[model samples]
Target chain A: MSYPRLLRRTLLYIGATAFALWVLIPIFLIAISSFTPPNEIYAWPKPIIPSRFSLDTMRFFLNSYGVLNSLRNSILVALLTLAFTLAVGAPAGYAVARFSFRGREAFRLGILITRMFPTALLAVPLAVTFIKWGLYDTLIGVALIHTAMALPFAVIITTGIFMGVPKDLEEAAMTLGCSRFGAFVRVALPLALPGLAAAAMFTFVISWNEVFAATILTVNNRTLPAHILTTIQASPLYFRFAGGFFMTIPALFFMFFIRRYLFHMWGGATAER
Target chain B: MAAEIRLEKVRKTFGKVVAVKDMDLLVEPGEFLVLLGPSGCGKTTTLRCIAGLERVDHGRVYIGGRDVTELPPSKRGIAMVFQSYAVFPHMTVAQNIGFGLRMRRAPKNEIKKAVQEVARLLQIDELLDRYPSQLSGGQRQRVAVARALVMRPEVLLMDEPLSNLDALLRLQMRAELKKLHREVGTTTVYVTHDQIEALSLGDRIAVMREGEIMQLDAPNEVYDMPANVFVGGFIGTPPMNFLRAEVRKEDGGVYLAVGDFSVEVHKEWQEKLEGMVGKKVVLGIRAENIEVRPTPEGGALPARVVVSEPLGAQQLLTVQVGKDVLKVATSTELSATPGQTIGLVLTKAKIRLFDEESGEALKFD
Candidate 1:
């Protein structure tokens, strides 16, 4: 290669390596510290590699008061958020992408504008309503708020997903003895599956990571992130590292399982052959 | 079985823009009717209304003697092939062709047999296991056709089906489609903007313009006796040449007085010309109907050639007659250079006259 082209490629590699290290090093440090014995975790200078591995810190973090309950609450709330968001947002997205009616653009803008309001401002009123409805301090109340928070992103992403599927295929199905709904289910749905999976992943991640809404809505049923934020400062350094490491694993596993579908969100799936 | 389709005073509009005006049409059973027009001329809209894809604001549509105006596309007993050849990209060729049967809950064996038969007919049998993305454009188009034909629909609707193909493949597929229609004998309504395809593939051509049908006739009748000036101009390659003329009476004989010269009107049209004396009319003549002669003859109009284009089989000469330019197609043997003076002989029997104001053909009986 010519000198300039070689120099440009080398610079690109350097930038990519720096970015990779920047994201991976903190996770690496927490993982190592999480497994290190309690005494070594408090060493004068932190070791790059642990002297020995032990599950004692992880065991203690798991056995702590409210930790296991909060872990279960987080999974339930994230699942509930995903189910509610898709059930409501998918049809709304389909309508937004496929139909042209008065106020269509306004409806989309209105959904997006819901996110512009500060969450803190709505907390007192939402908590008051939840208490009246007997939903405060319940997992369901926290999940409801997370669903509301993730809905705009779900609708927007699924709209783009549905738009990538050609209207012609659906119309063709309708002519071939399928009703309008049937056409959507058989033809448009299959074509949009990958992108929808990507949307579901985003919804899950958003709900899992959201702390403010979860913390404000639930007192006894705090999700993992809300529970961690409330208790991490009081804990020892080893417990803090173990809690961080535990929280990051589920999200990492979720992403790894669905990594192939993530590219579909970036226009890898199109109608053309 | 083939079934007739009838539209009664159908009209459709989209937000104050009329896509199809009040139109009436009848397609005989087993007849292949082509709706031919320019873009935005409502031909496709008319076809969609018949297919039950678009609802007419006023009027009724009947298919096989039943009122189907309120029915959805599936319940109307019609199958359509879209311009994009919308084969299901996620399905294999066999699955695509068998989708209708599957939707109707056909038995697995029956569905497989029907798909196989249609695939063999379309000559895509070997490719039935392949996905749409693995096939060529032409093959995917065949898969689409097979899917529609497998339904044995009462009426088949096609919206510019072959327009996406290359020119050579389009010609090939056009012939294949005609043959398939003949074999199946299904009533079909096809829409296209190409005059050649309309003339070749249609049993009857409905020429449309500006949301209305200008003429509906056999291909030969449409080409030979166009009902209006628009049909005449829109149907041919080097569209018909028109010149402004006025009817004049001299020596007890009627004549058409073009810019600086006059031609005697045919005897059968003399009386009609008498009533139109001093009235402006349009004189339309096809390029192939005008003959170029080397020397001036008794009834030939003298003209000067402006440009000559050799199209292999024949030569097209642009000749100036008085102040108007006319296209004349002649045998390739006749070589005429630019600025060369030539005599033009218009075939009197084939000449057409139109009202200058309305652009409607003036008939002489």
Candidate 2:
């Protein structure tokens, strides 16, 4: 290879690495500060690397009023939201992908338009309806609202996923003695699994990190993100940083669980066995 | 024993576009019927209707002795191999072949045995454990065929299954498919736009055009005696030459006049053209049947050679005959050059006549 081309490629890699660090530095700072001892968090000329590591902030956050309850509530709400979003959105995606119906495009556009509406605009009306339905301050109510928030994107994402699955496989299944429903179960569903997993991961992260509707719809059953927002201003800097890290940890793990599927869904459609 | 398939007056329409119009076809038991046509000619639609993959707007589909028009694909007792090799990418080949058995909840041993037998028959036993992505195109297609064959369906349908293969592989698989059909003897319906594939694989060929069957007959009969100008032009390479001619009654005998070259109509067509004395008709003659000679002979039409294409065993010569260029297939060694005048003799009995208005074949008595 020519020295100029090799030198140019090296410069390109250096530029990309610099940009990556620029984006990731704040997240890394937050991570390190979450593990730093409370006394060392705000030390003068703050240490680029803390001399000591401790879990005192995490322990304090976990022991705070309703913190553990909210943590449990957040996990429950995210799971329920994932289930509800998939239940309401996956079949809609399948229908939009596979069939030509009157108003199919209109239906898709209508669903996507819901995402343009401010969540805060719907929060008050949804809160009022939940109160009237005797679902106020319940995890189910909060999960339902999160499902409403995530469903539009979920439907759009899943539609693309199902569209990636070829119709030929389903027809092949049917001709091989499977009923229409059987074909879906045996062929299309399995091929669409990676996309479905990615969509589920997206819903779980959205519900886990959501705050406005969670705070509006629930008071006693506030999710972890809602609880942190209500109390973070009053907490110490170290405690606040620990709370942020705690809420982010689950999302990180969620991404980790579906990282392979995300790669498979987007690239390497068929890897050598 | 194999079952017969019958489609009675099937009509299918997609919105305002008619895909199949009042199509009727019958496939006898154990016979290979090929639906041959160009793309969008409704041949695949008819096959899909038989498989219950499509619903006919008005018609009945029967397999064996049972009406299967209202049945789902699984209940229709038929299997289909798609043009794209549709073997499941997620499953191993053995699982793909055994999927039908598993769907029917057959015993595990039975499913394994059937899958093994089919894999062996297709010479893909070693590939049974490999996923579709790991196999080559031909292997994947064999796995698809095995998957359908293991079902032991009453009728088997294939939609241009060999079109995806390369030319040499297509020829090899064509012979293999013929051998497999002979061994299994399942009533088969195949669809292809390639006339060569149709002629070689089909027991009977149904030539379709614009959502209608133009002719349904034995392959040799369809090739030797095309039902219309379309079939004649579509079935052969370097297609048939169509010349417009006027039928005239001269000296109490009918003769076809072709720009200063008039030939008496054969005695076989004498009765058929009795009432059509002054009518314009299209004369259809295949390239292979047009005999070209270097020497100008009596009763021959003189023409100039435009170009010659050597095709190994034979040469296809384009000759100019009174401002119309016609393709003539001659022996490769028959030496001829461009701008050279040659005498062409179109055999009388081999000439076909078509109605200029309707493009329908005019019968000869």
Candidate 3:
């Protein structure tokens, strides 16, 4: 094309490549180091590319004490968090999207305001309350905290999802022999499925990766991240890399499976037709 | 099964803005009643109220003699065609049309038969397997109509259903809707701001203004005998011209005195004008009712043509009479050009007088 257009295109490519490398390079290093043998992991001026690869580090990390139990706990907690967030947040989102009520704006702001408090600030008080309620050191206790952490995002995402579904479709269903609740269940829910999937993925990933609340909430029923955090500093270099790489796997697979839905959500519900 | 709908003392408001003020209306069974008004005049709100979509603040809604004010829309035995033609984008045409039947838990074979029958009626049978996104605007509209019609509801509510279509398609669909109504004979309440649609489709038109029905009558009567200034002005294209005049008893005859000229009141209206003497009134006349001639004829008021537009079959002439500009629809054969002095005669029986202050029509036997 013209000179300025060619210069602009080259600059855009450079910026995009730089951003991609910024995110991918760290993940790449951890992944390669996790596969590297323990002897080569901490070589002087560490190798940019691993010359030898083995599964010994991964095997050792997987077989370590409490690693398998903590993996199970992590999956259970993430699933529970997904269920709790969707159950609570979807309806709240639908309400915020559909209804015009007193203090609606304030209510929405209040939901977001919960996120402003750092986990560090809430952990000690939450631990005391959990002990009184008999939820201390339990997987349910950790999952509940994760739900609290992820719920704000869930509500905000689902509000946009439900808003994207036209109010007329629900009204049409109501007039077509469906009650208001029935209309919501049959029409609005189905139309909002893809976006809801995207929201669920976010909840799953957030619970999967969260460490701070998991560490504070439970001891014996430690999730993957909490287990990794406690052992990684004392563990060998290869074990630390393996632990980091293992924690990233479930979240990566979750993103991969629902990548299409994420695109659908970002493209928006109105883009359907 | 056709059903009657009645609203009594219905009043609805949003926050502080009143959408439908205190109102009462009755629709005879199987009749097409059109609620015609400008936007925000509450025509759509009234339709929603009848459909149980909006609960009335202070009224009872009766559908087929059952007080359905507290009922949800599903229990109201009504179907509504939204202006957006809200056929579910995710569902194929068959599924969309069968949705209501499925909701009612109808038998599968029965739902299929009903859907196919309605699809054939709407002539969208071939597109039944296709999704809404695959259909044209007109086709999607037909699918929406079929979906509503297949429900066989007691009352069908349509809210500006044809407003989204192009002009030519709107006219075509308008005719189809009329034919469909004839065949179905469902009691229909349609809302639209298009005066032509109301005139052509409604069995009786309710002309509304400021959340109140100004007139409710047969289309011809609404056009011919508007109840007030708003109805008169709102109902017609090149709307009714209004002139300020005074009721004067001169030369033993009752005359409506214009700025410098006067038209004699008919003998039948003389008694009515006698009491209205010395009172100011507004005279309403349609554009087609006035006759224009090149020469000053007997009993013809003097006028000058300011602008003449040749509209193929007829010429629309903007003529000046005193301080007022009048739009006249006359024969294209008349070669009346701009700045030409012309004589105008207002048909005696066609003249309508309204109270200046209240804008209410002055009726006479």
Q: lDDT winner among the candidates?
A: 3
Docking class of 3: high
Each model's TM-score, in the order given? 0.94, 0.94, 0.94
Query: What C-alpha lDDT, on a 0 to 100 scale, does residue B75 get in candidate 1?
Result: 95
- TM-score of candidate 3 on Cα atoms, chains taken together: 0.94
DockQ of 1: 0.80
List runs of model 2 lying over 4 Å from the truth. Answer: A1-22, A253-273, B295-297
Residue-by-residue lDDT tens digits, candidate 2, B223-308: 87899989998998887898888898777788898878886678877767878988999888888888889966787878899999
Return the lDDT, model 3, position B88: 98
Per-model CA lDDT versus the true structure: 0.90, 0.88, 0.91
The 10 consecutive residues of candidate 1 chain B with the worst lDDT sum are: B294-303
Candidate 1: TM-score of chain A is 0.87
Which lDDT tens digits does candidate 1 get at residues B199-252?
999999999998899999999889878888899999988888888889999889
lDDT at residue A5 of model 2 (Cα atoms): 98
